[model samples]
Target: MHFAQRIQALEKNVFADMDRAKSQAISKGKKIIDLSLGSSDLPADPEAIATISASLEDPSTYGYLLHHGTLNFRETVGQWYSNRFGVEVDPQREVLTLIGSQEGTAHLPLALLDPGDFALLLDPGYPSHAGGVYLAGGQIYPMPLLAENDFLPVFEDIPSQVLGQAKLMVLSYPHNPTTATASLSFFQEAVNFCRNHGLVLVHDFPYVDIVFEGMTQPPSILQADTQKSLSIEFFTLSKSYNMGGFRIGYAIGNAEIIQALRQVKAVVDFNQYQGILNGAIAALTGEQTTVKKTLARFQSRRDAFIKALNNIGWQVTPPQATMYVWAKLPQTWENKSVEFSTELVAATGVAVSPGAGFGKQGEGYVRFALVHDPHVLELAVEKIAQFLATRT
Candidate 1:
């Protein structure tokens, strides 16, 4: 069987290899503490669940959901965004309901790029962002995001030549893997850079509500001045509403980009079943106190994990948002994220994502997902300490 040249460029993933190691460890009867994927263990809000349950008896929801079928969900998302961020979103023209934001993130490149066009991506950004560019036959010029830069890419470092050839720049605030939040000022710079280069700006905003207490909330890239001119931002219900399994998300910003992504969707999938869309609408437009409670729970877990690690003599800063700790590996395991993750699981039954799986620049870290209870997190860290102590 023949495979495309584009598909061949990607190596079999390091994260998948870690997952396999985890399975083997679990099979060995090692009690597994999965800190790998960012899947939420929390329950969906009762109102949203009730909406879905009630819709279960509605036969109309079983049919293929076309573009316009998501109207209520889109309007709810638009209002939610406007209320939360002061970004005006027109449900009619500037909104697209996604099966999940990953779908939007992975497909938008196809709509935006001509073959061989470049995409300026964050190094160690969400892995799906790169996959999207590859599937679009676009070249990825990863802008290295380093610690000194607060894990935000510096537009100045992107080669003028690459920018000249690029069709889009993908960003995520309250970012995945690194769990770093971006400032509005940083987003304004990105917006200006994309405008000057004639590149589309795409922001994946899954963790927008997972922010910690005391830190100012992160801004949407669409909050930048050119957002109305040249940007589209994707939002997911997975993180905030604990609706990951429902696979509901939305894209909002400029009308043109939203239209293009919607058109791309028209070719690929019917919108998700209408019942899920209804449920998403309930999650978005209904009372949202669950959003704050979920944030508080994760914040508590983040504090517990960070304090436990620090008490055990491993210093990792508690992230301001996102359900992850982008921990730099200890000196002994520096530059071997995969090895460290694998060994930690093998010896301690604690699963974590090797940061290198996110990108080459992610080599010195491991991402710890805080999906488990604080007590479980405390135990995970204890096991990690034991594993570290046993290492030479």
Candidate 2:
């Protein structure tokens, strides 16, 4: 049997490899403390769940949901954006519902890139960004996000030739894996760079509300591109509202870009269940107390995990936002992230993501998702300490 070359590009999935190692550990009677993925281990707001439950009672929601059926959700998203960021959003022309932010990030490249075009992506970005470019037969120009630069890409470093062919620039704040947040001024610089290069700026902003205390709330791209010129941002209810399983999110940005993405969406599949949209609407419109509680809980977990890691002699900076801790590998594990992660999990049953899985620059680090309770996270770190001791 034969498969498309595009599928071939996806064969080196880090998560998949980690899953196999986890299974092997489990088979060996190791109790796994998995933290390889960022899926939130929290519950959706009761109001949102109640709204969906109510919608299930209505038979009309069982039918196929087209783009128009998502209007109310889009309007809710637009209003949510306006209320949160002080930026006006037009639901009719500038908002498009997505399965999740991943869907938008992965599919937008198809709408923007032709074969051999270039996409400027963060070196250690969420995998879907590169997958989307590969699926579209587009070239990827990885913009290295260095620690010295606060994990943000340097727009000036992109070569002239790659910039000429680049049609899209993908960014994320309170970014996945890295857990680094970007400021509005940084976003302003990105908007200007994209505008100058005639590139569509795509910001995957799933961790919008997971910001820890004392950190300035990450800005929406639209806040920088106030006129809705060259930017589109994807927001998800997954991280903020603990609605990961709901597959609900939206894109808000330039009208033309939104429409182009909508066209791609149309060809791929109809929208998700209308009930899910209703739940999303409820999540956005209801009292945001759930959001606050979620933030507080994650912050507690972050503090506990960071303290535990540091106690184990694995010093790592406390992330300002997001439910993740991106830690550099110890000297012994440097440049061997995949081997380190695999061996660590196999030996200790504490699974984590190898930084190399994210990209080349990610080679000497590992990402830990704060998906467990403080006690569980500390236990995982204790196991890690024992494992590291063996190497010494």
Candidate 3:
């Protein structure tokens, strides 16, 4: 049997492989302490949930929801953006509802790339970013994110040749896996770079509200691209409102790009259940206590986890934002991240994401998601210490 070459690019998946290792550990009677995936374990906002429940009773919401049906939700998103970032948003022209930010990130490439067009992507970016490019038959020019540079890509390093072929550039911060945040100056630099090069700029901003105390809140790309020129930003309720299961998010920015993405979306599928959008609207417009509480809880977990790792002699800096700790593996295991993660999980039932799984530059490190409570995170660190003991 034959399959599309695009599917070939997805044949090797790090998270899927980790899931199998976890299942094997469970089969051997190991109680799994998973720190691999970044899914939030926090509860969704009660107001959001209540709104969804109310929507379910309305028979009008049961049928197919076209673009017009999402007007209310999009208008709410536009207001939210204006209030939070002081940037005016024309919801009707710029905001497009998404099943999740992943969906928009994955599908937008279809709108932007013709076969073999180039997309400038971060080397250790979220996997779906690459997957989307591959599916669109687009070539990828990986921009290395080095620790020496605070895990930010250097625009000057991109070869003139790749820049000539590049159609779009994707950025996300507070970044996943690395948990690195970017400043407004950095975004301004990015906006200027993309505009000069005639490339569309896409920012995956799922962690927009996940900053730790004392840390500067990460800037929106739109904040830098004040006129929404050449840029589009994707936001998900998954990280901010704990609505991963609800599959709700939206894209806001350049009107032309948003419309093109909407065309691609129309061909793929209609909108998700109308009730989810109602819930998202509530989460956006309602009191933000849940958002604050969630950020504080993740910050507590970050402190506890970093302290516990340090207590075990594995010095790791606490992340400023996002719900992950990116740690360089000890010297002996630096080049063997996949092996280390696989064997450690099997032996200790403590699962983590290998840095190499993210990309070539990700080698020599591992990422731990702070999805568990502080106590459980500390316990996981204890198990990690025991596992490291045998390696020494």
State which candidate has the highest lDDT: 3
Which pairs clash in model 3? none
Cα shift from native, residue 91, model 2 (Å): 0.5
User: Residue by residue across 24-103, what tens digits does model 1's lDDT show?
Assistant: 99888888899998999999977888998999999988888888777888788788878888877789999888989999
lDDT of 3 at 155: 99
- lDDT for model 1: 0.88
Worst 10 residues of 1 by lDDT: 8-17
| Per-candidate local distance difference test | 0.88, 0.92, 0.94
Clashes of each: 0, 0, 0
Candidate 1, pairs of clashing residues: none
Candidate 2 wrongly placed segments (more than 4 Å)? none
Give a tens-digit lDDT track for model 2, residues 75-181.
88888888899999899999999999899999999999999999999989899999999999999999998899999999999999999999999999888788888
